[model samples]
Target: MCLLDKKAFVDFITTLWNIWNYRNNAIFRGKEEDARVIWERARKLNDDFRIHNFSIWSILPWAPKTCKWDVIKLNVDASMKANRTSLGIIARDLDGFVLSGKAIFINRVVNSESAELDAFLEGIWLAQSLNLDKVIFETNYACIINHFCKHKDDITIFGYHIKKARKMLDSCSKVDIKWVDRGCNKVDYSLCNWSLSNCYNLSVEMDYPSDIHNLVISNVI
Candidate 1:
């Protein structure tokens, strides 16, 4: 077995046990109030138990602190149809050592042109809200990126989204939009799948998917 600190192992087991018990009582037994009480009691017990041996191990840090680079990765993908299309956006802070925040936006509308525009506008709004300065916007659609960079003004159907994106771009100090292979954009694809599965609602600052999380961890290390 892999060696682990005895105290740390015990603490992990205890926390897991407490979580299981709370879930069992609340969800399985339908005793939500009692479960809440038990959860509070467990929290207090854990806190009291650690009072004597206070150590950094007891603290659970969700995001690592060593990450110095903050890069925003924005992606857009669309599913085309004869008369309609579906669009998706995945905007995330891809940090080297920290757990990044994610935002997913999706919509279904008539035509791929409109869908691309919507995705672009949504990405801009997300970047602005997160105060992202160094953005690396990516998409599987090379044509869209090329058009945006070349300042193509003839895309009337997506003109508004393009205009808004341009305005947002002007506000940012540094921005780079690029095209990546579809196989390399799994996180963006997952966000699209998730959006389609959830009926096109908005998910902001959601948990990263397992595959994406694993990829990020492996890369960071």
Candidate 2:
């Protein structure tokens, strides 16, 4: 859904929740001042609601307030130089469950920054091959996400990958690239670490992790 639609829907639901909660509170017994205060609070929440339309609360209202995006497509990999260069990419589709793919490129002269760019490029390529036109492309590396959407280009090492990825993206219909908190992208990070340890190219599919799958189901409902 678009940002405006998401925001409007969330505001309506939050207002409903507020009304329901206040109806159950004995303290809300038609006191003019108390009622005014409650109304004001609701109004304030509506304003605050505009700030995070993409948050999980906007979709799964009945789930815990903390529950957020239930499904994610993630790519993880790393690069290093210990007398030799190594790079890898782990692409995962997570929805209440996890499905994954991994790739390793040895002697690639990639650093952490380049690895992140490479992972995103590889993820986009995979998504395109799968015909996932509207999939969300997320990364913990803010710089990479920024670059993906033509925001800024401060990272010099991954210039080639960036250019190649952009050319590839031009052929896709719609791809939403976004920056996510590192904590939320832990699965991808783990895959990256695994690739580094194994020092081999890896690609496979995995079942959706429970938390992510549940989140997806909740959103659909």
Candidate 3:
């Protein structure tokens, strides 16, 4: 399912559902089942379901739009489970070209907000490492954005990290922190999930994980 669009994901699920229903009908109601026809029906149902349930806005691609010409955008996300937090980050230029991406695994337990803060710090460090002084950072966690907005650097154990991140931002020529919906940050979300699954802790420059390529294509298109 790598690089699957939303419609493709929905199609995959609906096909499975259709197969199940067809099997049940054949067993209980003596219906003749044809695989090809069933697949076509499933595809039609998926399209109809999307049309009926989703607005135009919802059907559009989930990736964020490109940033301003002179700005680079970084999307960061994290997945926490048990005693570990997996982080993902991707920096893209205004043309939606990936400058760098990272997948990280933090072997410690933390609350969701703290995990998000760590991911934010990772993004800042990444920007600094790349000498990218003008950046727009995005995340799905609104609370994380609000922490910086209110300067709440003394409320949690990770507060010190937040403060350091702020200092890094100060050194940047320009920086903007924004809260975006999960859908618009799918690349980083997928990277987080990948890191969690594989325990990866490395960064890629001028390259991307294969699974992210399709979604990246959709964004640039």
Candidate 4:
């Protein structure tokens, strides 16, 4: 377990325990469990234990400040309905001013975690489109972040998407990806709602739509 910190080691062992327990139940109690279910259960157990034992989340990094003039804090969000998923991204400056935004609707089916990862890739692409070098991408979802940051390599189907995001980030000069509390992501969530409701994709660099743009500074996180 080279450099597999406390949290990763805990989750890894929890997963093994879950797999063993699932195997026993399947044999004795005739409870058939899928691989996905076992993994999720292990993750839940790990999270619960972490909360009770170490309160690890209290030390999690929040949305970083865009202290420099060129640095931008980009909040990315995703919402899925049926098979269609909407991706929303909004960038703000140090003074909480809107810089760039995107709302993309993709007609495909993917798990919620995978779709959130898709929004993350979209955020990177959005940054590239704006030719940004210093940017901080914030998301409420933690799966992809933990996958890379915590060195969690799992058998989930979304692993490919995570790899894609990794290669995309390598070209950047300064990049930060972190998990922000859901309450702090209301603006992007609203942008996600708008995109899904209209089934439209939008990219704006300046003078963003009056409705969603107004939600940023008012609900600064």
Candidate 5:
């Protein structure tokens, strides 16, 4: 068949050996073989080997960093409960100092994707209201980031909000929209969770409420 890199070739050979062993067991030893289980085992084996030997994760661990000297980093998240959705955003400067943060409650029911996009839109507005000239908007939802990356003339249902966000972003001197894993977005998650229960459309001070102290510290540290 096709040639592969050294690591891929080794993995391929190992998977083939495992499959051949499975076939032998099924035919001669009368053992049952599950395709799903075999494939999962092969993947797990490959991943574990790479993790231990290659140490890839050790090089690029998930730690959200501060923005550039002139840019503010905004983390936004949405949490849905029954029919209502809570949107949260936290803005921090290059020194990890809080700039502005908000927790808003939307009174209507919306799908998770829409909720995420709505939260993102709120973040853009929040940045604009604070007169932030440079921004790096970060979200945990990869799909929403992809939505922003699409063409400006997109005709999808969420295109309106995306277009508005892009327009607001254009006003900024520098703007970046990026996706981070959930682990790196805890501050936004905490803000959304708090908003769902306590703060309904409230603007938070730099020294946020006592409840969010740990979360803010964790992110800054």
Candidate 6:
């Protein structure tokens, strides 16, 4: 527990639980479960248990309000330290259930705004990959969202990236980008910071294998 990192720690516990479960099933039910199936099931339960408090928060009166009915929101953030950049993307349904999330790490990228833009684009791609038709992409950094509202030439590298982001947004049929305050987006912000320090890259489908969820509990509480 003290030595292992977050992801490794979560996996260790989940695997233990699954092994105990497999033992009981074999003894009581005389069932022999496949090893691969057991491992997959353990992975699925990782995030479900990791940030179980989030589900509790989802029902809280103070939980961040859903912007529009039936439209999912993707909260994204990024952190840069030295030449390391990390991007975090997390999705929530209208009802506040955490739909999915990702933590990505990149090397040799030093700019903060560039990291922020990268995170925003990753959020968009994740939502699209999930086949979400209507998504409200959000970031806590106001400047990036505000910058997209204007028209600018691709004179510099940042400008070129901005143009690329604009084109990506334009291609989306029903995607909107907005700036939310950081307090409301603490979950992804925590994830981004954690990824920066640990260089952890992860993706969770609705729920699973998200070490960030564990990182999030410390923030919300």
**Candidate 1 Cα outliers beyond 4 Å, as residue runs:** 1-69, 80-86, 93-108, 152-161, 200-206, 209-221
Residues 179-211 of candidate 4: C-alpha lDDT, one tens digit per residue: 899887887888787778788887766687777
Give the per-residue lDDT of model 1 (tens digit) for 1-221: 14768766665676678877777888988866555666677667766777555565556444523323367677666654333345556665664332233334334355566666666676777677666667777777766776677665545645545656787778667788888887656655555655566545445345765666775455445
Model 1, total clashes: 0
- Each candidate's number of clashing pairs is 0, 15, 0, 0, 0, 0
Query: Against the true structure, whose TM-score is highest?
Result: 5
Range of the 10 consecutive residues with the lowest summed lDDT in candidate 6: 59-68
- 3 versus 5: better TM-score goes to: 5
Q: Which stretches of candidate 5 lie over 4 Å from their true place?
A: 1-69
Highest lDDT scorer: 3
Model 6 Cα lDDT, one tens digit per residue, 55-124: 3444334543233436788889987777888888988886556778888988777677777888888887
lDDT accuracy of residue 82 in candidate 5: 63
Q: Return the candidate ranking by lDDT, descending.
A: 3, 5, 4, 6, 1, 2
Q: Quick one: how many clashes does candidate 2 have?
A: 15
Candidate 5 lDDT for residue 215 = 79
Whole-model lDDT per candidate: 0.61, 0.57, 0.80, 0.79, 0.79, 0.75
Question: lDDT score, residue 204, model 3?
Answer: 73
lDDT (Cα, tens digit) per residue for candidate 3, span 1-221: 87999878888989999999999999999997789999999988977777567565555455533323468999999888767789889899988888888989887767888778778888988887776768999998987777677666477645566666888788667888898888878878777777777776867777666667776777667
Candidate 4 regions with alpha-carbon error over 4 angstroms: 1-69, 151-157
Candidate 2 lDDT tens digits, 65-162: 22233334544445465633333333444532444455564655556776676677677766655545445676667777666666355355456567
Predict model 5's lDDT versus the native: 0.79
- Those runs of model 2 whose alpha carbons end farther than 4 Å from true positions after fitting are 1-72, 77-94, 103-109, 151-161, 206-221
